[model samples]
Target: MIDKIAWLHLVDGRILSTRSRGKDVYYLPGGKREAGETDAQTLVREVREELTVTIELSSIEPAGVFEAQADGKAAGIVVRMTCFTAEYTGTLAASSEIDELAWLGYADRDRVSAVDKLIFDHLHEAGQLS
Candidate 1:
């Protein structure tokens, strides 16, 4: 299984998503945790590297956990994603391997990765997304 963390930046019923260079779909902003790093640490670092924004660790909170067949991988390979919601500093922009960023609503679900779709489902069910 591939493990990763994600930031669920929701505002006005939309979530933040990013597309990597040459990729067709968008993904939540965050990355795999480094050795010995906590979830919040990975989120703060990855968000900064990918979006040029600093996540306020003190405001970080668990959003959800989701798993799905890893996109473009062999069957049975899965990606486990842990998500968080938090306040941030600075502005958001695409950086690092990210080429574009978008604020996605429930109507844009199909444009995201499998695991991100699950996140959308949960958020929509909880009435935090639309």
Candidate 2:
């Protein structure tokens, strides 16, 4: 399995998502951990790298964990995504590696990766997403 950490930023019932350069699908704004990194560390680093924002470490909260077939990978490969919600500082802009930034709602589910679809569903069911 591939392990990843994701930042779940919700605004007006939409979630923050990103699409890396040359990638077709959008994804939640976070990424894989570097060696010896904690989830919080990885989250802060990834969000900063992808979204040009600083995640407030003390504001980090467990959102949920989700698993699904890794998009564009071999059929049997899966991804285990540990997610978090946190307050942040700075403007939310797509960084160099990112091609686009979007605030996606439940209706935009098909635009995201497999695991993000699950996140969208969860948020929608919880009435946190429209």
Query: Number of the top candidate by lDDT?
Result: 2
Q: Which residue segments of model 2 deviate by more than 4 Å? A: none
lDDT of 2: 0.94
**Candidate 1 segments whose C-alpha is farther than 4 A from its true place:** none
Q: Give the worst 10-residue stretch by lDDT in candidate 2.
A: 14-23
| Collision count for each candidate, in order | 0, 0
Residues 10-90 of candidate 2 have per-residue lDDT tens digits of 999998889999999999988899999999999999999998999999999999999999999999899999999999999
Model 1: per-residue Cα lDDT over 9-111, one tens digit each: 9999999999999999999999899999999999999999999999997899998889999999999999999999899999898896999999999999999
> Can you give the TM-score per candidate against the true fold?
0.97, 0.98
Candidate 1, residue 20: Cα displacement in angstroms equals 0.6
lDDT at 122 for candidate 2? 95
Clashes of 1: 0
Pairs in steric clash, model 1: none
lDDT of 2 at 66: 100
